[model samples]
Target: MSNQLVAEMGVVFIEDSEHHFFNARLAVNGKPFTSLLTPRRIRDFLERNNIVYRCHKGKKQVNEEKQMEINRAVARHLGCLKRPFQDGSPDPEHQYNMDESHFVIDLDDGNPLDFVGAQSVKYRSIVSDRSSGHNNVRAAKGGSNARILCPMLIFKNKKSSYPILNLPDTVYGVYYRSSPSAFINGRLMTEWLQEPRCWGHAWPFTAARTLWMENASGHCESEVEDTARELRTTVRLFPANATEKVQPADRFPIQRIKEHWRRLAERRNIEAIRKGDWKTGSASSGKLANPGKQLFLNLASECIKLENEEKDHNSVDWAKKSMIQ
Candidate 1:
């Protein structure tokens, strides 16, 4: 009989295709059924059996079947990259990741005081305003060997300046620019590609290196690829819809940076409170003001260090997930 017919007949003949569900694992020693049933058949079987899908921990909210296929693609891609050196293994130092992270300034991410079981809570900031969320600082980070390649900070303005008196940092200083949205663009990406500090850190000019980046519209533009070719660099894009699982930088650094930035924001808030900066005049008046652009710039420099990197992964097989933690 067709699998669809068998499932609809309620014969209990189908095992979960996801193969990760608790109930499915408890059934038949957690072994997947020999027959590969279509997702429609599996869904029908579950619905008929009164089984409902439960969100699993650490799993994204994508269609389970689609996620499974994505995982397979991730494994194949990583597996191909993991072959021995004689068979073209990637040089850890030359294998780099490039990505952009948008940061909001003068924003308090702290949870406001609320009573237990309250359905909702709201609090007003003494200095922060609604407009703070729209203004972003885009940090373009290049990393390899768990080290940052001196990040470039893009601010949301046609023109702006930093308050730091120092000309350059002794270690891992910053490169700054301006964009209307404080986000990356094709021109900005091309500019980054041509920066000597970026390529110089990896090798002599035109020395071959592997760059892993997302297939975003901006990065895939002809100009960006053309610039990379001039530098003797090869760009490999992350598999579609699988960056969360396969991107080392996305898989790790962003969370660490966000946490550190939060701490900095909190400390700044406390200082402001102590100095009565929140009090505009006779009393704390007006919206709470955000920290200046400098805070965001400092954040980019601190984020690319080895200590800030992901250090505690269980080293799950790369082919099954990612090559790095």
Candidate 2:
């Protein structure tokens, strides 16, 4: 059949689907319809039947023109931010941005892995009786400078307070707290903003200093603004609906750093399992223990040390690109 005819047929199928046709069995066959029981099933069914469609990689997407507008606005915002440094202090020691990278438990699924070059894959594999039905997580948020501040670690607990982190004198201290869901909330946001190192040290672009952050609900709390004001800092909200484009901490730094985190976590997780060290099991639970906290601080300190020594990559514009791209 010609491609045009197939495309027209595909439109007809879509119209039928809108009317709940996919949910009904075929009139011609009282026997089971081979597949496609819901609107969402249409894509996979069409693919199996040798049909094609253009698909964007992520579920969430914006119109091309809209994204272009967002990019241009971000470029302009970045240009204005650079003006403060242009007067020749050179290093933007006063400007900074921060964001959170949350890691979740993907520990065990019933799925089995096969040897890379094996001729025949075996079916028998270990499956636990206590299989998990839901995933849990904890998040870490950190600020950036030539030296990254100690990551503010959130631990999971239903308590009002957590054990004080006895930070090693060599690196910046880590702030930790507990929450039921382990996600950062208004309380944590307020606490983080209150930290002197967060904004107190940075020189302002205007009469009032503002810290740029994405429009997260927690970050927009009245208390957060109040706390920032108390610290003599202003809270700068990122453009609504523009994520990585306007979020200084969400894009490039995360992309590269997350890759490093994965490599380090994966190797340690596997080695720990072999030696019966259960601390490597969960990203937050076992890993946020005293030893685990030490692990994170040390690893981060090492990376920061290297960043400090690498003069070639430390140009003012490059630093801006690295943190906020």
TM-score, each model? 0.62, 0.52
lDDT scores of the candidates, listed in order: 0.55, 0.48
Model 1 lDDT at residue 297: 57
Considering only N, C-alpha and C atoms within 3 Å, which residue pairs clash in candidate 2? none
On the 0 to 100 scale, the lDDT of residue 289 in model 2 is: 20
Question: Counting only residues 3 or more apart in sequence or on different chains, how many pairs clash (N, Cα, C under 3 Å) in candidate 2?
Answer: 0
Per-residue lDDT of model 2, residues 96-140, tens digit only: 455665543232222223333344533321211111111111112
Candidate 2: misplaced stretches above 4 Å? 1-93, 105-147, 164-173, 197-208, 278-320, 323-325
Task: Judge candidate 2 against the unseen true structure and give its global Cα lDDT, from 0 to 1.
Answer: 0.48
Model 1 alpha-carbon miss at residue 3, Å: 54
Tens-digit lDDT string for candidate 1 (92-189): 54666776666654332333333334554344554364333322222233324344456777666644333234423333555666666666778878
Worst 10 residues of 1 by lDDT: 134-143
Q: What lDDT is reached at residue 207 by model 1? A: 52
